[model samples]
Target chain A: MYGNAYIDPNEVNKTHSVLADEDPKLLAEFEARIERGEKIEPKDWMPKEYRKQLIRMIEQHGHSEIIGALPEGTWITRAPGFKRKLALMAKVQDEVGHAQLLYSAAETLGKSREAMINDLITGKSKYSNVFNYPAFTWADACIIAWLIDAGAIINQVANAKGSYGPYCRALDRICTEESFHLKYGHDNVVTLATGTPVQRKMVQEALNRWWPPIMHFFGPSDKISSHTEILMKWKVKMATNDDMRQQFLNMYVPKIWDLGLTVPDANLKKNETTGKWEYTEPDWDEFKRVINGGGPCNAERLAVRRNAEERGRWVREALKAGQTAYVVPFA
Target chain B: MNVAAIKELLYKVADDQLVIGHRNSEWTGLGPILEEDIAFSSMAQDKLGHAQGCYQILHDLGEANPDQIAFSRKADQFHNCQFVELPNGEYDFSLMRHFLYDHADQIRFEMFANSSFEPLAKLAKKVKGEIKYHVFHGNTWINKLSTANEVSKIRMQTALNESWNYALGIFEAGNFEAELKNEGIFEGENALQNKWLEVVCPLLEKAGLTIPEKSSWEPVLGGRKGYHLAHLEALVAEMSEVFQIDPTATW
Candidate 1:
């Protein structure tokens, strides 16, 4: 599963030299190789631009996992039942685990976990904008599970065949755990939808608040793009932004409608002609603003993370000092 | 036998679990590393799950739903010992509490595993499995922290001092001592306390800390009796706010 399909050695050399020197000929060869579908491995030479783009995308994905825990964590204490509490806790834990896997993948590119965390703390990095929205109530947990995770799974599944071996491996693990999250969220939402009218209202309200963020999760379409050409040529991203967003809409919009709940988008519908989903495009400016740390709960989320990191400094110190001939746990 | 007695017993168990669970949860997203964060958070979730179970039992036996029992009870009415209620001051303190409580809880659950009360026994049987992992986690942290620097040792000792009396209070018999022991409802408090000391004192000594001496101590009685500290009210307010907003509504 972790193995990569081999690429031509001369092509690898050309790609590296092109990236190192920004030669147009090498870029053309690299783009042609991607067009022909070859998996890039760690030992394989790659364009410098490709390495930079992959690091940026992968690091941002990792940070999103870390920050994503904050929204659902607020309700752990107040979950109505034992089962619900356990499930919420497990879901939050899974996100942290996902972050670890992604960070390790990023580390394969010669970046340290400390540096990534520092980049996040100093607001020099980008995570998914969806995480910046507030989880206002317990139902918001269901929405996060049902909608946010669903959106993520769509993106991840598209990237499952990514060129990087480590990133694909990490995505594989994340996808398995995410299946559990998806089921749990659907269960929660179903219960609420079938429960008292008030419960139904809570679900709807949460959906209303979360809809735009979920739609924007794929980022702006490639046409509005800046990094598309470099990212695509390097095989760092396999699908266009619009393609992933459309796939998400096609998969989830029907599921939401079947639950007898109203989706916030009035124009959302299936087109019989193109066999594709049609919906109002999300506000790209809002997407830009939210990702730039301007979302409603962005400041609060960062503050919480910073405080916890600072408070736990002593624990790390103690563990580091205590690591004398320590045995590593079995992987 | 009286309503007050039943309320007292229920609140005591529920509050202890809630406080300990809350303190344990503070480690979420902040463990020394990611895997440990997930594991620590899982333990905290298990504790909260157990607390919710206890509250459900109490609610069924009396006048409130689990939420009402957990969130509406006044602080003074909460019967949890002060030990579990304190903030998780640091990793060392949190680890100490886990080490102490998990050990005690394992032994306590072992006794309940054979309880005459079938429901309690069954619950104990389920909880015992989860507690096993908790104990392992506690032991892991203890071994790591004890062999570390003088700072960890110092922090652990101070945490022990602050929590020692309250930890002992976990086994405080209150009015149920004789009936519970005579009926074999569970193990007696004194036996449990002595067993706890036997297990804990040696560990503390090895870790370069001294166990404080105590003769007779006045137990903080209200947690079991439903009297709680000020924090319980705030905790309950936050926990139950959504449920209480529209009681008839399904959340």
Candidate 2:
């Protein structure tokens, strides 16, 4: 399960560098094709700014997947029984496989996987902030697998319709597997929510703990987000943050309610007239702080990832030794 | 038919897979490489699913359901070998254990493929095919790491030495082994042990690793009779920590 690609409010604050200058003829062809719903292949001509934004988005997304595995991966051992145990391992392993796919997808845009990983461990690149918080219980893993993955499916489905050929293909495959995880996670959460009192309490507490991060998941409301008319036109930014969040609440809030679990937000309900969700504003300050590396698990998560990179450096080196460079598959 | 013998055989194999499968899964996010992590997890899922299959057979034979038998049992009641119960200390140790255990598993399941019991024989055919891949994966790593460099070779050798006796314990016979052998339900532990050694020794030699001398081999027994090292209780407890919260809950 993953959170949406967080657009740092600060990143938008930067001046739109692409709008300042570019060869107008090449830019026109790129925008016109995107307008025609054409996929931009790896070998195609694209504006420098298009390449930069895509690299940033896909690399952060790839980083989110592998880093996202850590928390749920912890529960694979203590996952209650043979069924849950096997399912969790397969599920977590799928997330790592998604990382591999996303990394290769990101690679087509010119940055190497090694470079992206380095940026990640060095805190230059960012993953979803939701993983920076701990999964404190089995119930938390369930909630993440169910609700968080649901959010990712929404985000990824939107992005799968995107213009980049490799990333869209990768997302198509990812969404198929993610559909299974949603069922698995929902079954797990439902088992707890409608179970014995202790089981219900455990799930309830886990949901309460995760709700804040879930709220922060889709990023801040677009009303306060950056001007992205260009990116939207480029088929990069698919939907506004608020629109995705509303869609999620519309689809899942009733499911959570049907399970007889409270969502922790009293004001979390649809504004029928506007056809949007109305709720307490997520503390964007906390979101900013966490994304900037102040959340409970950020240090530990990055440390673990760094240690893995360092320890595996030898194996990675061994693999590259005398290895021939082949054309990477874009499909 | 020796019902007690079949049940005993089933429990030991099932427990071994469960424990080792759980250990393999511990490498999920912490493997030396992402591919290795995924490899271990794939094998882990297969092993765990195999355990559930064995438990389902037991369930059909009047045992409690698979979940209860797997989750509610204490360490003292588990029949897993001590080799599988040991903590995964490092990649080298885990890899060595995988190499050792999978060889024995492949042979055991292959033997079971011709068992007198038709159901077990049918299951064994499918399981043996899966174990063949597992053994291949283990052999590739063992061969590479054992000859890769001085450090990896030293680590693999050390892990093999430390785990040698525990690996032998995998063939500790149950009380009805002779009866099961007589019935052709199992071919007996001694026979299994001989085949395992025959398969693993040459592979170790080819990997440039030494097998400990015959006199030094003291197979840790009693695990088949529910005895275990200090590690089993902790592993069992950790595994069931969440399940014990509400055993009747659907989760």
Candidate 3:
């Protein structure tokens, strides 16, 4: 499962650059269509900015899936029994399939899958930072399947109402598949929670390890700016970072407590007055550091991806040798 | 029905499926392409499920449960051929092994579809359908890569040469071979090997890959009698790492 699309809070003009040269009439018409709740298809008249931002968002989202498969994929061999092994394999496969779909959606905005992959391997792009942390144990994998995917579903359910036609359609399908992931994850977690002392301790420790990354999942709250405003108006961003995170907390914190598990944050609870969950602020410093390639698994993750690309070069080259020029796949 | 012979037959196939399924799953996130990654995982799941199915049959015949039988065995106690226990050296080797192994696997299931053992015959009918797609996938890739270009063709050939003997080891006969045959519980390993050769040889030939000369056709043996390569031991340890934590606990 994926986190929300991570736009650098610092990349201000890069998001706003298309407004300077576009025809006002066309821009107005495009915004008007989105305002009327209509999707902006690939061939539709759009401001260059919309296409650029959508490409970045969708590409990063796709990259998240590809990288996300790595940590849990490692556990497929060591999963406790046939039931978990089969479930985890199919779940990780769905993550890869989600990458394919998202990549196709991004390709509709003009980036090729190869180009996106190159960016990912070269560390020129970003995926969900939670993946850069290790899945140190089977319990860790379960926490990811349950809580991380729980966050993704909240993020994705909001994004499914997004204005990009292909992305929305893809999210709709992805969300449906994610339901199974959520249930599978929850089942594993429940099994562990209600299980022996060893299992309970394992799941609790895993929860402690993952709580920080889970908090950073929706990303830091958006700074109010015209760029954010325009994207919101365009329906490109269906929800704010803080809003999605709050939705996650409001829905899940109680369930986590019911399991007799402690939230790593002692202050984690709902404010009966404001109706918003309150907690210690996550370390945005660590989030920024990890996103910038300083996390424990970043180098290893990229190295593995790059190695895969290098080893498969011949296969890809052999397939492409006499083929026609690449055509954008159907979204 | 000679239950001993049928149980022996089931053990070998189940062990092969479980071991190879474990090997193929190592490609979960590391395949040559995302599609191939997903494909191998899909096949891995199928193989694992098939292994579980066989173990379930064994369980019905008064053996331990599937989990105990699968996850509790030591490497030397397994019946899988040494071929499937080897590392996935590269995409080429893995693909080559897949093409070679799946063909033999499909034919074995097809032959068992008419077994006098009712449960074995029933499972064979269902599993044969799935193995057919596996063979089809292997064939499609072998045909494509073996003829794609010089580099791909040579890689495919080298992998084929290195893998041929081990592939032949897949049909290593068990002690129950004669009884299984006489009881009609199986067609016997010799018949299975001949039929596998008949299918794979022409396909490899059509793909422009050369079969090793008959003078060099010594099959690697002993896995059927419980000896295995160093790899299987480590693989078994790693595979059982979590289960062994508390085998009595429901994971």
Candidate 4:
């Protein structure tokens, strides 16, 4: 469910505003810890920008998980057999649970889960845009479970090496579970691709439909994207958008071809000389539009989440009625 | 042992689990609390897996595979009591139904654990272990929410009232009910129903909710004979929507 959190091309340029109010001595100490690969814990001193950026990154990851569950979750009832049903249920449950873990992780930095969720529903925060597109068929779900999760593991594995204690730990656990999801997804896609002609066509079409979104998943390349040198120095941003995308393509494209499913883009091939993938450029305009809420399922996805929030309000209220105090648990 | 009797018993048990499990799963991301969401999804997975376990027994007795039997059956061919097919209206209704139906199912499985039929007894025994948690979850929620607030109590009572008749249909006797009882394949529905009432009445009373009177109870029937409510057709269609795409595919 994780796609890179799309950075606004402008926000990166304004990050220095964080240290304008900080004691230069404390800022130097914070940088020294990050430079030495020490984890920045909750009680640790941090520049305002470090807290803000980590919260943004982790909260977006959490939102992606929950919203990501919706598209695949819809397939649980209709999954072809008991094996798929049980696995899909467990998989989607893991996604929601991941959101819980990640929200808690983000909470360690001082933002409340309620406030993070509020920003999500209000569109003040962004999740991976891949979810804003529909899972149009069973094969689409299969592709997501396999390919999108593949992308997440790529991004998350790199992020697990990050300097934040909680988010890194959460990513480690998340990657372990996502590995199984990758297996389940791969099994499903293999089944469809090797099935009857009708099924083969279905999976191929699904790949075709999803390939563009997958290409757009890691966000725009650094050459055309925001500069995040400060966050990188903090180890908060572990890999650039292009690096994660290439890692995904490098690992998955061959496996996708081995399944005998064609990549939708004719130009998709690895370069022997450059040792990198060469593919048609993902349309940044569409990525921008979708990330800004123009995709087919963006409205529907948020509305479903918003409706769940509204309908579930009374039960949440009733459960809270007798509780004398509320505490946000540590991640 | 009457094979038809055993198959009949299995169908109702398996169908109820599958249908209700499917309904319970609808709460996955939508539950009021995160813990409740995880709880409902876990229970849903257990119920569905239990349904599959029941179908494996049928497959040994020469039915189609579990997927085909489950996904290919027409709505009217389903043997689940209508109580389960009713949509999850709200958490109150869902929680109430879980409490009532699972109490009966728990006792039913407990009774079956001693069945003369060994395959069934084995499945029932294993299933009873999982149903323990289900009944516990149901009981805890009913107990907690019953006195939680005025609104919760009203909602719980109304859902209990609305669901009572369809719930009774869970005990509608099979055609081989007498033969099964004679062979000890299962205790008769009448006996199960009596025991179910004895167990449930105390909990309802403790929760300060009314038990619908026997004379007023018009137990809705025919679901055991493959009749169902309208909602069931739509549920079945949705369940098969993707599977029907390529019936022969491995997916």
Candidate 5:
């Protein structure tokens, strides 16, 4: 059991120095417990660095959920029929709910929800760069449901088995709700793909625009080695970035091909012998540029969010007063 | 019922839901907080879903496809009241609309749960489960905002004042109200309206606001008869852009 394990901080030499004398021993014992397939609970003693890494990863994930709504929210009014409108609305609602669940998980790390909001507003936090792009057409909505959410679900499903109790629990809920999102997307894609020539063209165009970003969703594999050892020791992450990226490609490439849609990457293919997907790597420089606040729609998206918070400040304050003035006339 | 009358009734329900759903959806990424953002989005979805249900019924009755019925219809053909179509100017405005509409819908759906039209009644019952959450959310905000701070109280008051007249219009009597009530298609609008006021007045009063003056109130007609404000045109245009591109398309 995890409770029975002990770690000595000094034993493991980390790139970053550890001040906690007991941290190295604790990490070793923690790693041993993980190798044995034990679960890590919230109250267990862990290295401060492990907690910090988890918070960074989990909080960014929470921010992504909130920001993710902007792209699809634009379509609620323009949805074709009542059924389509309702479906889109439900999907967007799920994104918001996912954000709530994720934020609650981050709160377990002793961060206030208010503080998190401020971080996002002040540009001190990071969210998924994919959201920084615009949803220019109705077809983009379907794309978001299929590709964007599909990417999110891949990471979330992996997190469902993460070490932290709160995070894993939150992931469980998020993954369940996300299935509806994926289905909604899949339904729309199928409909569009089978529709008239114009719709097919629209769906294809949307796929073209989204393919590269989806590839980048896994982040850079080589640039993120420092924290992997510790994260693995804690069982916070199940696989490497490259492994997860390959997994995503292997699953989705065939599905896209079945739709008769070509992914933007001409070199995309499956390696039969290795049982892995071999695809051209996305532009790592562009990924860095986007994450560093240089994406196409980043400014506009952030402005909208900041403005909403500012404009709604009065209402929040009004609700704080606690008084009732208007009385309805009885029947 | 005559085809024209059926079409008019269906339009009123569809347009009302579409407009209200749109307004609610505007809060998708902009809600005050994360959890509330999701809650608000869910409510918006429900409204759209209900609207679509009404549209589908009309289509089955030979009106048009739900998409065309929703998007291709001219502004003058829209039957939504002005209250539902107004922009979500502020959170207070949005919340007040939610509070009033949710209260009215609860009463409306309760009457509808026993509708003579079995299909409508069954759908109403299904929707009522979610509406319960809307009412709960609205009531929670009403209580929270009413007692919150001076600013929130003022904002809520102002929002309530702005929405008061439109709230009255939700009960506006269309030509079919008599026939609908007579045939047991629905309960009387006056009774539902009265119950709405009775239920909401105390809550509003307790929240530190006064109902607006009614002397100047006048029912704006035509949303039930395919007449609408200019906003409906632009809304429909954007909404139907994709569908209109190829009406026969699968999407």
Candidate 6:
């Protein structure tokens, strides 16, 4: 399960780090390759800004995968029965696998996985904000498996066409596995929704709680700027935040209604004339707060991760001692 | 066929797998590394499937469904030995336990593969293939970490020592062991334990870890007779928390 990479809106104006310093000839060739639908391989000549932004985006996506596992991963033990227990274990395992894949992809860009993980545990980097909210019930886990992953597919399927070769290839595999996760989640939700009244109430409440975060999952609507425009042209950002969010709504809102579950937003519907979805504006204030370390599970999530790192430090050091050198993984 | 004896054998084996699988699944997202996390979870799923396979045999023998049998059992009603119910103390402890327990499980399945009981023999044949990789994973990591450095070697040795007695509990004899051995449905626990030691002792020595002295080995018993440590009670309650919500409900 993943959410869109959260690009800080305020960083759009950092003129000092802009691509203006790149040689005009190389910059033109890079843009031309992207326009020709060529993937930017690891050793390709890319502007400094392109490399920096790709690292940030790909690293954040990887962190989101590992951190994302924490929420649903907790449910593996308490899953209802053998069917669910087995499925949940495999599902969360795929999330961890996704993190591994994403980390390797990011490693292609020169940042070591250890360095990226250090950034994650120290709060120097960010993952998807939706994970900061807790999965309060089994139904909450179901919602995450279904809707949150549904949103990720929407974001990732678009990015799978983006220019970076490794990230795009990683997303291609990720999207295939995520399709199974979506079906598993949807089946769980369907079981709950179509079952006893207690189950129905459980799923409905989970949906109510998760709806806002789902809306915020793609991050706030992008503000048009030179940086945003450049990333789009570079194929780093395949779609605007709102476009992906709208796509998610268009794809999943009907299915939610089909299950007889109500969206918490009264105004959520696809307008036939304008061909768009209308819903209550998500609480961007809360999104910013949560992404900046104030959400319900933020501290606990990072603490768990840090504790894992701390507990495993000796093993890491032991393995590192035997290694002759550090090798960057091939993309 | 002695159905009662066979069911007794099935319950203990299935419960062991289920409990240990539950313990292993707890490692999700928390291994020393991402690859290890995924490895544990994958093995966990295999364990759960193995448990389910045994439970399905039990269900065919007029037992409750797998979900009900697994979820409704109290800690005292379970037959899984206490070794698997212990907490995952650290990676060292967990890894050592994995190495010890998997070898035992693999050997048990190998013995079962040739049993007179056709259903269990067939299931055992399939399960043996899966547990093979699990043993391979356990052996690979044990060899790597145990030989890596002084700290790792010390930790691995300490983990082995702490887990030795509990690991011995995996073969706690059940009531039907004599009948099971005589009927050729399965060999008894003592044979399994002997073969387990023969298999693991050399591997541990090769990994450069010490086995606890024979004089100090006191297998923690009684879990085979519906007795368990308090750890199992909490594990059971947590495992069934959602299932118990609406017992008759499909979810």
Winning candidate number (lDDT): 6
* Candidate that beats the other on lDDT, 5 or 6, i.e. the better one: 6
Rank candidates by lDDT, best first. 6, 3, 4, 2, 5, 1
Could you give candidate 1's per-residue lDDT for residues B195-251 as a string of tens digits? 888887887788677676666354444455555666666666666666676655555
Worst 10 residues of 2 chain A by lDDT: A9-18
Candidate 1 lDDT (Cα, 0 to 1): 0.73
Q: Write the per-residue lDDT of candidate 5 for residues A1-331, one digit (tens) a residue.
A: 0000111223335625653555678778876776787766656776776676677677788778778888888887777766787888787777777777777777777676668888988888788888888888888889888877777777778767877778888888888888888888988988888777788889899999988878777767545423456556567766666777787787777888888888888788888899887888788778778777899988888898899889866665554354567332110
Q: How would you encode candidate 3's per-residue C-alpha lDDT over A65-140 as one tens digit per residue?
A: 9899999998999998999999999999999999999999999999999999999999988999999999999999
User: What is the overall TM-score of model 2 with all chains considered together?
Assistant: 0.95
- Model 2 root-mean-square deviation: 1.9
Off by over 4 Å in 5: A1-15, A19-25, A223-227, A315-331, B1-6, B114-118
Off-target runs (Cα >4 Å) in candidate 6 are: A15-17, A223-227
What C-alpha lDDT values do all the predictions have?
0.73, 0.89, 0.91, 0.89, 0.76, 0.92
Ranked by DockQ, top first: 6, 3, 4, 5, 2, 1
* Candidate 5 chain A minimal-lDDT segment of 10 residues: A1-10
lDDT value, residue A65 of candidate 2:
86
Where's the lowest-lDDT run of ten residues in candidate 6 chain B? B174-183
Q: In candidate 1, how many Å is residue A138 off?
A: 2.2
lDDT of 4 at A74: 92
Residue B56 in candidate 4, Cα distance off native in Å: 1.0
Error of 3 at B66 (Å): 0.8
The DockQ figures for the candidates are 0.50, 0.64, 0.83, 0.70, 0.65, 0.90
- What is candidate 6's TM-score for chain A? 0.97
Instruction: Give per-residue lDDT, candidate 3, residue A199.
Output: 96
* TM-scores of chain A in all candidate models: 0.87, 0.97, 0.97, 0.98, 0.87, 0.97
Q: Which stretches of candidate 1 lie over 4 Å from their true place?
A: A1-18, A22-47, A322-331, B1-11, B52-78, B213-221, B248-250
How far off is residue A145 in model 1, in Å? 1.4
Alpha-carbon runs more than 4 Å astray in model 4: B213-215
